[model samples]
Target: MSVHETPRRPLRVSFEFFPPKTEAMEETLWSSVEKLAPLRPDFVSVTYGAGGSTRERTHRTVARLVSETDLPVAAHLTTVDATRAEVDDVLEEYWQAGVRHIVALRGDPPGGLGEAYAPHPGGYANAAELTAGAKARHDFEVTVGCYPEKHPESPHFEADIEMLKRKVDAGASRAITQFFYDNDVYERYLERVRAAGIDIPIVPGIMPVTNYKSLMRMAGLCGASIPRRVARLFENLDGDPATRQLVAATVAADQCLDLAERGVGEFHFYTLNRAEMAYALCHMLGVRPT
Candidate 1:
């Protein structure tokens, strides 16, 4: 690392948003969308609700993006609760609405994660199957979920790699990992993926923690470990939203820079219906609107 070395080009970014449940929230959500649209993300995704509750809203948001914005939109589809035919119908609807990209997922069970995962008798069995269905229904650019620390239900790393391979074989063009604080976790998992001969892009997912308590709870439920230092950074900021946001942006910026130094170029942000922190972090990473 020499002082004469030039900085690398800004990395590509994407954002994930959930459909709003109320008028106020809808306004907030669209405001966030408008704020981040100028950054020219590779694509933006709208998440389908648990048990597919927001199916219509998700479709509407993605449809609006297609009709109203210049940014490409990826609709998140899951096969956790619906029959294969039903899920395929949703995929068909998205295609008709002009969605060319999909984030295929098995989705959380109706009972939620850590509970027993019983597949719908007639639905796609897993993300791999969902990816295959999406490809069969339409020529979509599909992205599947990856768990760098191993999905909680997976017996071991080899099993995780095998699952990823299955999805790739089923026509997934890329993988977006669950958010993690440790860059080493992503780097090591990537090495394993490459060693296994899976070469598709694996974009790291980043969740900027504006609320420490909420972040910790989500991380615990999802099997994403929070480093002690990360906890320490927010230990006493419980009452200070302003300072918490500043620290959140700084931490995410550092995480992205570390990944960039290691040659990783793509990031997927879980915006959680807010854009300020993600926008700030992108600014720090040298990303500007095209």
Candidate 2:
């Protein structure tokens, strides 16, 4: 009999969630949380809406997660709409609410991505400043956003790398990259970041494509290129929701396996308020429920 060996340990996982707007959505979000909690992710994050529109709801969710669950919560904060002091105050509030980690970002403009990003008059101009301010006010474990395929606003890849270095220098303990479909894109970006001497962990972010049309719209806004192959996978699946989900899980599972073979062990998943897909991928990566 031949024995197949298991990986050394399950990849460290984290989940990202957006504050729910409706009662039904909130129920779904908590249900998903309950389902995945047994896996014991490194941390879970709740996203603040653009321009801090969901600031209160985000706070409520993070606070509740801390109080009601055993999970550590990372609050997503941005420096795009408010003044420096205003944003800093919010960071302080998160600390008071028992949130010890934060995902700092130079948020999308109120007009959304693709539009010009004009910093508010008194705001920290970018993510780096937000990271520094958060660290200064408290000993928060700060995670900043990164883009593997280059931020759309950046003029070139080199410029994007320089910006990432700046964030690292400004006390970002780690970076969670924007999700991409191609493993090669992430590998190349990681190489470039390492070559630039930025030593912080750059955790890959993965988004399972449950809804092809919606995913494409989001990818377009975020500048993630959807390959023709990906499109073909969902082309004839409009009438087959179950198969589409299975395919989505398979694709993401393959992406993680490729990363793991290269020694990547940390993963951040954009859960979209759902658990089955992320949970299934993590299970395949050797994450067992505790």
Candidate 3:
């Protein structure tokens, strides 16, 4: 069978985490990291807050992971509300902290979530610029984000693909899509990306619905659709934590398995600072502690 038709590629997984703002949250994040470390994800990424708001926190978290764990760490960098020199310094810091991978992004608009994005006058214009800068700084394995449902600001899919092509031209090595529910959306997107001559690994981003309400909010913001069938699964479980957890795991595992059947081997999970769901999903996908 052709590689695309056969599920022969080994399953590979990675995770993304956000920096904590409080001491209690910090403890929880570390605990989650500890539990997930045994699975040996391809890499663990720490996210930069909107407009670099959590710059120091993100740096500290990523540096600690680099020093404390054997897993590869990818530090996220954004071209939001910062000068080129400032971003350069942050890149330098990541390099000094033993980081070799970067998740480069244009980040959210400086005004806030709903505001129109405007690049800082003195900073890199967008992810393409940031990706190029990181490449110039070091031999970093740069990964950029793609949207299967289309970015909220992009005029259309064609324009969105063009922007992604720019990132690829600027030296991005991989692309992890925004969280999406339907494997078909991802499958179609992969076809478009490949047709555009973009040849990087397009990893699917899986978000286990920990809280239905929160998932709705995020989905709205990121342009990910809520399939009626999937939404129906969580319709009446708002107050049941235990049941919600079970449902979330079952649904996410099914999503991954369906993708695997289509020969998708890499997954980047948005952990949301929780380990149980990701750990369970990884186990379901045949990743176990070594």
Off by over 4 Å in 2: 1-8
Model 3 lowest lDDT segment of ten: 1-10
Using lDDT as the measure, name the better of candidate 2 and candidate 3: 3
* Number of clashing residue pairs, candidate 3: 0
Model 2: ten consecutive residues of lowest lDDT: 1-10
Please write out the lDDT profile of model 3 over residues 1-290, one tens digit for every residue: 22242344457889999999999999999999999998888999999987789899999999999998888999999999999999999999999999999999999886656678888989999999999999999999999999999999999999999999999999999999999989888888888888898888889999988889988987888789989989999988988999988888889999998888788878889998999889888888888888
The true-versus-predicted C-alpha distance at residue 148 of model 1, in Å, is: 1.0
| Candidate 3 segments exceeding 4 Å error | 1-9
Task: Name the top lDDT candidate.
Answer: 3
- Candidate 1's displacement at residue 244, Å, is 1.6
Q: Local distance difference test, per candidate?
A: 0.88, 0.88, 0.90
Runs of candidate 1 exceeding 4 Å displacement: 1-8
**lDDT, candidate 1, 138-209, per-residue tens:** 999999999988998889999999999999999999999999999988888888898898888889999888
lDDT tens readout by residue for model 2, 101-131: 9999999999887789998998899999988
* Residue 103 lDDT in candidate 2: 93
